[model samples]
Target: MSTRAITGDQWVVLRVPISGEGVTAEVAAFAARRQLRYDLGDDGTLRITDPESARVIVTVRWKTLPPQVPRTLGFQLPSAAAVDVLIDPGPGLAAGRIAAALHDALSGRALAYTDGELEGIRAAMPLLERYSAARPAFDNWALIFRDHYLEHSTGFVLAMERAGIPAEWIFALDKGDRTWNRERVHATFQARGYRSDVLDNTAVNLPHAHGDELARVGADIDAFLDAAHTAGRRVLVVDDGGLLARGYGAIGAPRTADAALELTVSGIKRIAAAGPLAIPVLNLARSQVKSRLGYREIADSCMRRLQALLPDRKLIGRQVLLLGYGTLGSRLAAQLRGLGCRVVVVDSDLPALIDAAESGFTTYRTAGQALAATSPFIVVGTTGERALSDADLDLLPDGLVLAPFATRDFCALTENAVHRGGASDIPGVGMRFALDRGRRVTLLGNGRSMNLFEADSIPNEGYDAYRAGTFIAAASLCADPGRVPAGLHTAPADDAIAEAGLWSAYYDLYAAQGKGAVRPPTVPAPRLADLPAPVPF
Candidate 1:
């Protein structure tokens, strides 16, 4: 059925095939929830009018009679009056693809929706491609992402190559176990029809590397940057923190060379004074941490999985001492509380402590007091700083578990303890550090980021947001490096919105395929009395 050109305004019609009875209701519900006005026809036609300035009309038409009919979604462009998009709702269509198509049809315009409405559309549709008529230029640019055996970084590299961007990868291999291999990573990239040049630096992986080894790695990065500069290629470095930040400093001040860095918090602080244009992908924008597909999801999922590893230590109905009430800490607290664990949050920041208290969690100004009071079954550090002082360790109860949500720095205080014959290997629990001779405290992942060390890989939904941030960073740098200042920057508003939509769509698709659950945990709200009273200053 053809949609008649309604008089007075142009329309962008989206015609989708209806295979069953519920399709129309689903579409109507989606439109209503989005606050989009629609006109329904008895002949199985629905017209959706965009309230924005574009005046685009989306039409959904049934190709077959009544139920079990195939449907088509078509979009009519207002800018290009003659252009129209007709997409067949093929068998096994994914919600993400549909959303991508719609977003693409709207010319990448942001759509305002109520909370959960985006997820609703994502669940209803699942997968669609955002069709771009013109691929952006990246001829003079090259991308370098830190490969950590996750699909997101590799996926981003593949995507950049697909967009005609020259891309390479860098892998900080675990020298002890060779956790990441250059040959394996290259082979994986080769399978996708791309040649990979990975800077496999073992020194970067060694958190405790010192002396000549660290200096050698620094020189290696300096040379790499110099080569890219001499070649006149704009280098976009992802995962520009930790060891990589040290390398950036070794290269001296940022020259007039074409080099841009996308960094985490630590990286930004290290290189900010050097005057290199940096996009702070990890924390600058609240969206990066607060979004549905954020680190919290990964942290929560990983923490819950710890139950199987340490079956004897029951996570449910146990007290958890959380050090540092940052994004990761707060999210993990809520998830643990959902599983019936009493969560006590400790943070030096008064505001963070207050926030935790307000969120119905017991808050403490010092780790020692929290540990002594709670006698927690598990202690998690999320502050990215040394969470446990030597004094605090002395206060920890025997048989307690210590897990770091951040990198190893958060647990640095335990290093000396481990070296002084304080840690002993537990049968199934790995190393258990003894603080006061007899008090055995199990250290998870040797005080590394438990989520990264324990989880096989970050969930694809969370990684999708990471990939989006990387893409935006690279694209922004490529578009005009000079336009981006030397200071830190957040993902552009439009890119953030587009990425959020993509993230929801991908999450819904993953759920439809039984990959994993992307929905946030549903927990009973905590009562104020259930938590300890806030410590007075």
Candidate 2:
């Protein structure tokens, strides 16, 4: 029997021992089979682009050296027949599948791992294993609503089941999901005993859609609740908060969740805006584990994606204006500074600004002040709220590139009446708009989280510990829904997460283990104000 291995969101790099011509033909066949397009650059770089989105899904580079030259390209030059296959990083098994096809076509030695090495190279989930051993019996059925089709998400659901949480039904919003994540989710659920629904028109501003779209999502939730109730099992909502915000507050609705775990800060805000909640809601967004540990990974992804999207622009010694000094923003500022970029931060919150200043970043009270003083080449928005107003767009430097880590950061520009109509699409990149006096500013993504815009932002292993924390919190909340009161609970969730011994598991699993294994320093993260802002319009 082949060994099953655990993995994360990553790109697969395969080196094939075939001639350049042979590999190129195989790649062409691969693209033609999928109805994809390809571009062969002058520098022996072959790119496979998606037909619909115009995004590069795969890249192939050839390595060749003369017979007389003794220089090796990192390995023994076996007659110069090696071409590196770079499968784009995504959320599903598609990359692996593509790699397998190419490997087989070229009759090359094993370079694809997931499909090739079905056994070995798998990392064990220590925290999940420990929690599963405890046998936290969750009697009720669960309405698992999260980003669907992600490999890690599938792993998360499987982990939940392993930890004794029964998922009655699964729901995923039909937006911003990677193609493979959707395919993997559908295939996984179909094979398993659970029914999953990809709710259309529920990705953003749900229940507020007024017509068919709203009705469809509402009916789906109603059906899930009814089924769980008929089975004499209370429904526990494991959400990113979209479904909970949409259905949990329906007046005279069929039923409500017994307990809920809200994941993202956006979800927490949505749940609050939708009126009073009557069930115990564990605030995983504000938990110490997520805020302190998870945000760092998220920030890292943001920076990585920014660099990937703008491959030609040099990051070192660049002038950057960073909007928002919250958890994600602060971390991004520090990282940008570390990369030798002169990073200036802006925030409405006084304490956050003070913290940024003390952290050695140039800080400002508002974005306008920062814009007036510095002409930045890149403007990064980490504020989950509106970072730039429509009028403020005029003040931006000519040829400025806006990289939004949050969805609503550049909404003012993207949604502006004039700019929206006049904007031109820069395929593979984002939208480019002409501002006043011939100044041009480009949005690096579709005004969504740039890191997640057609890209897997964080690695699966990078966030495994936090996912474990969420699971621990969910298990605790679902085990006894009434143990805590019916409001957003953060500290208690953090307590439960801390007790799960995730740090130890993480250290053992990821960090180097030796005689002198140094434990990370315990520094309490600065508390951000819990004041709720209105959901981005």
Candidate 3:
């Protein structure tokens, strides 16, 4: 749908269908990127003001449609909603394309502009494209977990569709995302002729309701697998540990995928706890491409989210304690030092502690020791396991902030906080638990990866190589499942991704000077709580 500006003497209005995702954050981020001043009100209304004069330049208004009438231009709207962008007709505002740019941003549709104008618009907001449009043949169907807001992930799914393999279904389980519209991805997929619907399992929280949500998602997957089996098409599972851990085993029905690809280290741990698998499982979690390249971006995002959460706090010259000196933790420790902070690193592994000590950081064997030695204002947790024990909770400094890169790192406080004073929510910042002796600690995120807590931390360009590598691995595995035995395999997928010349593609796209490495537009990092939440469906 092409969105045109309805012009008047004072304001120009741009109307577009809303997908019930986080539209307010998208608009606020748009304003922040352009260095434009924007304000969000309590009633879900947004106003963009002039930076110099502080006068209102634009007003974003939202309109809701009744359930009886939900179709627009023959497309089903996720929520009965639409948004109107009211812009000022002032010169130098690029008034003609502001509405169109926002329209394309909110709704992933083609803009009604000339070729030259289209090029400019693309430069303003570049979408992810397949590294190579080579249509490889694949036999099995796919069920993948993806954050639809990320364009690179969306591109990965589209690339699979372009290949012979069909996406039977896609999953979006992140309930805390606030920047991009996952529903837009859902609508875009439907519009592009893909028969996949985003299975939203976001309503399920972790720890307490983990099994409940997993069972719900597993049932859906079981049904999909059954349909695929009846159609004589074996399904390939691309899991992020959410399914393979417990839910995949709970399926009482005789439904299983032909092959599976595990994505994260946490996922690998979950799979290990779940015991050996029946089908061939490829491990992309241990791939060199991801370890050598992707972890850096992940660490960068972690720090970015931390900084966004503490915008007013100064990091320079302050002592900071970091748990786990693994791939992500090591990188985050370095980043913390680079920010001029006194970094204290803790690791259960002796070699890791020695490595941190050799790297000129204050190393400790546990969080208790680190807390006892240094009075850090911020304590970062990267260990996937429990970083702080129940006894260690007694050592927490007053008003110390805890930033968890993994979910279970600070589970001691989040999952079970035992103190005479109790815990309370800090609004945009996470929960603040009162400790004994009048000391308290604040959790930066909801006991999950801080980078993924209501924020699009990693840039599409930053993670392009890893996603492409995953695609290469998936295509190669599906083409010949016999290559990997009926067990979890890592070397085969790593070799395949390496043999596919992914590093060359990545270098050419990002590192090599004068190559087609185009830096995508910078995504604005903001506190998501301040942005408008989507209207519930």
With a 3 Å backbone cut-off (N, CA, C), the pairs that clash in candidate 3 are none
lDDT, candidate 3, 128-147, per-residue tens: 23332444436545554534
Global lDDT of each model?
0.50, 0.66, 0.65
* Rank order (by TM-score, best first): 2, 3, 1
Worst 10 residues of 2 by lDDT: 113-122
What's the TM for model 2?
0.71
Provide C-alpha RMSD values for all models, in order: 20.0, 12.9, 13.5
Per-residue lDDT of model 1, residues 1-537, tens digit only: 122222223323433222323445655565676676656678766555555633334555544333321111111111111112232322222322333344343321111221122222222221211211114546656555554543344445555665555434232322121222223334455444443343322344343655476656556556665666667666555554443344442344442224444434434554554444333232322345334555666666567546645766657788888887776677788888998999998889899899999999998899878877777888877776667776776787877777766554345444474543656655434576655576666776645555555343454444554455455445545666666554455655335445436445445534555446444311221222332222110
TM-score of each: 0.61, 0.71, 0.70
Would you give me the overall lDDT of model 3?
Answer: 0.65
Which residue segments of model 2 deviate by more than 4 Å?
Answer: 1-126, 133-136, 165-168, 172-180, 198-203, 206-210, 247-254, 512-537
lDDT of 1: 0.50
Using TM-score, give the best candidate's number: 2
Error of 3 at 399 (Å): 1.1
The parts of candidate 1 lying over 4 Å away from their true place are 1-134, 167-209, 247-263, 269-292, 409-414, 417-422, 426-429, 491-537
